[model samples]
Target: MLTYRQTPPIPALGGIVARFSQRRCREAQRHVPAFDLPARLDRFIEFYLGEPVRVGTGAESPRAVPEVVLVAPHTRPGKRLQMLGDVDTFTIHFEPTGPHRLFGLPLQGLADHALAAPDALGTAVLRLRDRLARAPDFDARVACATAWLGERLAAARPADGLDALVAARITPGMGPAAATDNGRVALWARQLGWSERHLHRRFIERTGLPPSLHGRLLRFQSLMQAHARAPASPLTQLALEAGYFDQSHCIRDCRAFTGQPPGAFLAAWPDLGRP
Candidate 1:
């Protein structure tokens, strides 16, 4: 059986964090093919405590993943994951600009690649990993990780308000007045009192993708959530409600993000994404 737990970060780190989640499974589910959809908006930093996990970008096959991995925001799918043996994983789901705010790294550089945590943060991440591994219980693990994050935040430079502002706008419905207008980065720029090019540069630097692409991905996420909640809902209705131009537009977006046509997508993974 698979069990999962989710907890919010400390209030001080709330701006950069979405939540921390842990998942464990003593035996892999045989009936369902275990996999994960492409991450959108929030980046995922994962810590594996069991056998090496397998991940692949295509239907061809999967390769072993390292102990620690940071998955950047993504749209084009084909990313699949399979857990082996008994599994225990702790993950950090970061807000859109959290990668920049927390790690002090260029978000674009980390895009779509899962580099070793040690490689990304040198000894600090490795030290944290060791501490987490040594933790006596789940609560201890959470305490250790968040304490490490607090120290990192203390040492790291502060984020520009603009980065937070732009990242905030990329979410589903929480930002400036004009945030609801899809694909209108220029209008958002005007609303923020900044030039479009300037806003685009900051967005690429802090969130790894341009504003338009991020917005589209968020829209796609909405559709996926909608489908999960009400699988019987009409496709056209879900598409239009989620901001797709039409059913075809939704299908095209689904294909681009999941590498599967809408029907095939729903059929292949009725549960949609890994927990």
Candidate 2:
């Protein structure tokens, strides 16, 4: 079994969320309840010194990731961040932006550049684990960790920026992709003056997934949302609004991504993956 404890404090210059997880042998079959994590995240700082956790026995299999990008427990601070595959259970989150903060400049640009440059950010993060481990008190730990992050971020702000675009064809009421706007994505990227490759690269750097995959994830989320609002809605209608043309098309993608059919999944987790 797996258990988690979380202590979330007020948002600081950079938001901090701490989660402690304890789990026995991992079961890839285990499905973590669905949850919508915030859209923007700087990076996750994880320090776990207990039992080892494993994912995808063969390294390319669909291991239990957190249904999203996660910083795995065993990945120490200095190593390149390991993509936490769908974890049987794990908890860690960091959001650099909150309602208020004193630093007015963008830091993700710097962090990304630092992280990509010979893993400098990784090295600093590795030191964080050691610093926190030696901290003598609770207040000291938080203060020290926050300070460690602030210094690296202050110097490394990158020249580039992360951006958000209002997706034209994927909005709440947008019709099927085949009907409403088949090339909207290409047009939007062109309008932003970014090539597909550039867009995909930045997205992957920040989101841990390519834009193509991100599109699919968003579509899946839309389907799940529409279903929750009208449980009895026909599969055809659900598919159309969610950007799929036919029921079979939607089912195929759903099973491939979530490993479950829509109806059976809803039956088991009635509250949209929440408790």
Candidate 3:
């Protein structure tokens, strides 16, 4: 049997973490189908305690999954991953600027890439992984990971000036106005007394995508989330509610992000739309 669970972060860590999640398969399996992870704006740090899975982009040969990996926001369509044998993994889903703030890594270079934890985060992660493997249950592992993250959070460099302002405004659950406005970058630059170019560069350094592209992904994610909440709703209605100009516009975004129309894409993997 396979089970997946998502748990919210503690109240104090809420700003840095979106959630903690676990995926486990209790028995070994001969064949497991690959799944598509649709493009999104959040970053993740995943820990694998069992067999390594395989991951790849479209049409490319999948590679063995790392024991611990740090994934940046996927600006491209998304990647494919398949689990074999028994699977057990835990993941930390970070806010848009969480990784940058916590690790002081420039996100632009990491965009669309998944790096081994040791390379991206150093040997300390290996120790954490060892602790996680030694834990008796999923909750124990979550506690271990949370404690490690808390230590990092305490030592993390504080965001300043534009970074602090942008981080405050653009979070994982930011509203549609900040996410759907096409001219938000220019408006923010003016409001913050910075040049548009400066704002664009700083935003990419912090979130791994330009403001416009990030907004587009946010809008697409909003539509998918709405569909997950109201599966019976018509695409047109969801599109309008998600800030798309029309159903056709939503279809174009679906095609761009998932390589299929909304009906076919969502029909193929109904639950993938949920966070």
RMSD of each: 3.0, 9.6, 2.6
Error of 3 at 20 (Å): 0.9
Write candidate 2's Cα lDDT for 1-275 as tens digits: 23333344334332323222322223312534322221222235345323223234222432322222323112111211222323232223443221012223223234212122114233555566566657664455566655754564444433223332422323346553432232655665687787866765655554444445445555665777777777788878877777776788778766655456766654554341211
Model 3, 165-209: lDDT tens per residue?
Answer: 555555444565465465767777888898989888988998898
Best-first order by TM-score? 3, 1, 2
Where model 1 places Cα greater than 4 Å from the true spot, the runs are 29-36, 170-183, 191-193, 270-275
Candidate 2 regions off by >4 Å?
A: 1-45, 58-121, 130-145, 156-162, 166-182, 200-208, 221-249, 263-275
lDDT per residue for candidate 1 within 1-275, as digits (tens), equals 66777788888887787888877777554523666565465687888877677887665688888888877876566677876777778888888888787878788756667788777777677777778878877788889888988887886557665766666664565632244364567666777798888888878888888766776777777777777777788888778667776688778777787877877776566351432
Regions more than 4 Å wrong, model 3: 27-32, 159-182, 270-273
- Candidate 3 lDDT score at position 207: 86
Q: TM-scores, in order shown? A: 0.86, 0.46, 0.89
Candidate 2 global CA lDDT score: 0.43
Q: Rate the local accuracy (lDDT) of all candidates.
A: 0.73, 0.43, 0.79
* lDDT minimum window of 10 residues, candidate 2: 72-81
Q: What TM-score should be assigned to candidate 1?
A: 0.86
Q: After superposition, how far is residue 168 of candidate 2 from its true place, in Å?
A: 11
